[model samples]
Target: MADHRRPPPDILVIGAGLAGIACALDLSRAGLSVELLESSDGVGGRMRTDRKDGFLLDRGFQVFNTAYPQVKRRVSLRDLCLRPFTPGLLARTSTRLVRIADPIRRPGDAASLMPGRVLSARDLAALAALTTRDVLLPASILKRLPDRSTAAALTRAGISLSAAEELLRPFLSGVFLEDELETSARFFHMVWRSMARGNLCLPAAGIGAVPEQLAAGLPDGTLRLEAPVVTVTDSGVLLQDGSERPASTIVVATDGPTAACLLPGLTVPDGRTVTTYYHAADTSPLAEPTLVVDSSRAVLNTCVLTEVAPSYAPPGTALVSTSVLNDDRPGGEAVVRRRLAELYGTDTSAWTLIGAYIVEDALPAMVPPWPVSRTTRFAPDRYVCGDHRATGSVQGALASGTRAAREVLADLARQ
Candidate 1:
């Protein structure tokens, strides 16, 4: 039997998302008594996965980047059994489908990048220079560059407008979840650099497996699920069931909106909404593990998940994932299905609708002049951390949590 009159824990982490998990893990490893509470039955807030009818559908279309420094620090890549996507894109333009490949990664595919295929000689040279600077130059130097929209940054980099519109806009829009390419130039450069330096892959199990792995590392009795916190006071959090959990310190590590609800006046950025549709196909539309983007901006991006990792689908069936900006329209799935057929140049009529997920606050917007990181300490003992406080990525979430843990440790040491 547990002691009901015991003292409160040293740290109480609200939310079991990546940020909360990372913070709690760090605090516990440092010999602190921590209590991590989650409202949901499982972990991974936006990074969730659904298993239905032998198909694995992620909450939204997501990819794991191997170049994330935080991910490399916390996760074992080998344990995830990651499957890499091709280091290029199959872009659909007004005229034809363009095949773009990284010459450094695929030397034999270099011919596909010749002038007039996807980009002009001048544009290609400019792109090469930009890639070299981003991938080879130090991040400290890139961070020092002027803060501006990604579109303006590309123009300044000497990339032609044609190349920007045809290739960069379509591809990067999928990444930033905005079609205008108006995200922060520093953030864009870092994303591009990561792609250039590492491979984009998927876990053999599902995207949710990433957070599950993080949760598995925590010490027993530290995590409590289905423990919805109604309010957070200076002392601790109050549950909806009229139960109060007292703690010496608290960390709010939830989504942008939820965090704002808990900590009033906490500025939460406007988030990007996305809808992903999963379809079970008899066969994959494309044989290769490449992402297809539409230059017309009809849909954000589409890929055959089974092609990337055969384990994502059952035997003899393919799982296709399509993502589009959420517009709250009727019969949107039907419209997307038609577009998918056109993009793949195959009949999608027979494809079965496996699942559809519409995420309201998928990611925080990273507009120009945005601070790449923010202060995590809210008060003497209260703190807040999430991707919203950083660059709106898994890396940001993990990094922010790590920062919060360091702040807590430092404050405790001072005491």
Candidate 2:
């Protein structure tokens, strides 16, 4: 049932995902008559909640870092009510479990990055120096180079090979979500800036709340749920149910390819899939709420479930989520379980597998020099928005949405 009684908007926003919501939120705040549309029944898109027998689970385990500048500027953390995790991480090496901490804070713990484990002092130093290069000297430093892969530039800067895999690879690759060798150093630096910002926290309620909040503050008739947008012609936009939504501007605020579909021949990257593995456990295997990585395993990274948001799980339960890279893994559950046993010294028989979402084609293939020429590719009156448009992750999506809004506004002002 479509809510077609409302008046058409000055700006029609397609897709109700985080990016779309963020754009709509800002546009409406500016007093623009905006109408947001969603293909799905819910507003959150990939970020909706799943209510089970008693537990409220997220579509995927989503974490927000204090580093995301757009999130901090756009929404208040207190309003959403986030839960913070412990500052340290638990890294499980082959021999034993190790708790890594900032030496200044936890002086009692192991002094090295690996923590509670022995490393060749030389390797440790190399790793530390490599991190300093990636973290401190990010994209802003490489602004001069408009064209070149950042990974190669890092190598040129003398980041050692072993150091790349052991240290830089784990951190940078996880942040960028792809092959280390191919990524641009500029993008790497962008990720580093985020890392330098602050703590990483997940929503106590659910990631969907973030978008829901954005959509909530909108005035009545500003949003249309379950409205499948069919086309974006020269005059205006079209709806799925044979209705035309004519507007001064149409925001193609959708994932990369989805936008391309509406406005044919839009040149965006081919989307890739991601598998999010959620394991509910009686006790968390990893220490603290910090993120863990196994570079050798190609398992992007894992985080402590209970530490970030205690409410994610019911009484005495821990929620573990692992987000894979661009490619899809068929047997993610079994693979995650095997990896868990290898690290935690336990089997999957004990833990309850609550949610395992596999977006066969989740995000677009971002092969660095990202934030590509989306402005040129999209239709004149309709702008695109999503993680893949500019950057990736929560902040990336936020930025994309804001960018779309800004672009649309500029066009309107000129007209």
Candidate 3:
């Protein structure tokens, strides 16, 4: 099956995740021959979805934020049939469920946000100032702000310790996949701005549809699946199947660890772990598509998936997804079910477990002074791109990929 007469592609992108697909798409659009190789059976390295027993389960509890700049540029939101979650989250405190909603967005929830109910006067003032500044100002201004641990930033802004523990910590632990708010303050502000500006939604099909859409833009025969690259040869790469493909340039667009393996001396940050549990019930527990976090800290976050998008489950069935920062705990399923019962205020004993996904490297640790973007040029001919090289997010991945393509194009032009 060798086409010896035909020349090798100008560029070989080793990975078909969003970053690789984006790189290949940009390169090909510029009229270069590019091939994308995926180690797995399909694209969407981490964003993959599985259909089990007629239920659409995402690899993890994933939500697409329409506010991400890269998402808007790269995806057609209309085609995904997006369904939005409520603008705010519910915190299951000791006494009752406290609903913290955006007054401007959800005017009806204005009653829930009245002073002394959810957030104290001081906490409300501090958060309002933070949200208003982050939303109105440009990213450049926010990024230039002094960097510190997110916890420090919140405290410095006058958010009360009680509010941090009750509302912010529980909600953000799910977002950052870290219980401690040690992530960069800059990244936190940016994320906060995006949340305030955009709709947090899920696609009718699944989060995997986002990547599937990007891969569809590639030219025919541009992608090869299950073609794992064992090592980077001098002239190209050696595939796991014992094949050598030569190329003028190679971009390692895999995850942090894989990129480090392919391109030695590359810096790979520490990663966070997360586990998501999917449960199927005969009836819906929560009628609204809202995220619920526990002040008890038993579960990071949980939501009724079918409430957001009916297509996630078969007719008349409800799908609930819950995520914890770590893998299976000692108590396991029984513990999670009990926690869910408390959070949703409904008996979860009858709910059947669909699947549990433990993602070891859910997101790269974004410590203080982390670069928003980094150069992808690893060597003269070798390059790398992923969320690891930028902020750990969908926007970061896509942005890094496009940046790599630009760098490759410039390098090739000079040759």
Using lDDT, rank the candidates from best to worst.
3, 1, 2
* Position 136, candidate 2: lDDT: 67
lDDT of each: 0.90, 0.68, 0.92
The residue-by-residue lDDT of candidate 2 on 182-243, one tens digit each, is 65555555655565546667677777778887788778877788888888866567778877
TM-score for each predicted model, relative to the true structure:
0.97, 0.86, 0.98
In model 2, which runs have C-alpha deviations exceeding 4 angstroms? 1-4, 86-88, 92-100, 103-110, 114-150, 179-181, 325-331, 371-377
How much is 234 displaced in model 3, in angstroms? 0.8
Model 2, residue 237: C-alpha shift (Å): 2.8
- Candidate 3, residues 1-415, lDDT tens digits: the string is 2225446999999999989999999999999999898999999999999999999999989999999998989999999999999999899987789899989999999988788988888789899999999999999888789899999999999999989988998898888889889999988999999999999999999999999999999999899899999998788888887878888799999999999999989989999988999999999999999999988878899999999999999999999999987856786778989999988889999999999999878799999987788999999999999988888889889999999999999999899
Of the two candidates 2 and 3, the one with more favorable TM-score, higher being better, is: 3
By lDDT, is 1 or 2 better?
1
Q: Which residue pairs show backbone clashes in model 1?
A: none
Q: What's the lDDT for residue 57 in model 3?
A: 94
**Candidate 2 to truth, TM:** 0.86
lDDT, residue 388, candidate 3 = 89
TM-score of 3: 0.98
Off-target runs (Cα >4 Å) in candidate 1 are 1-7
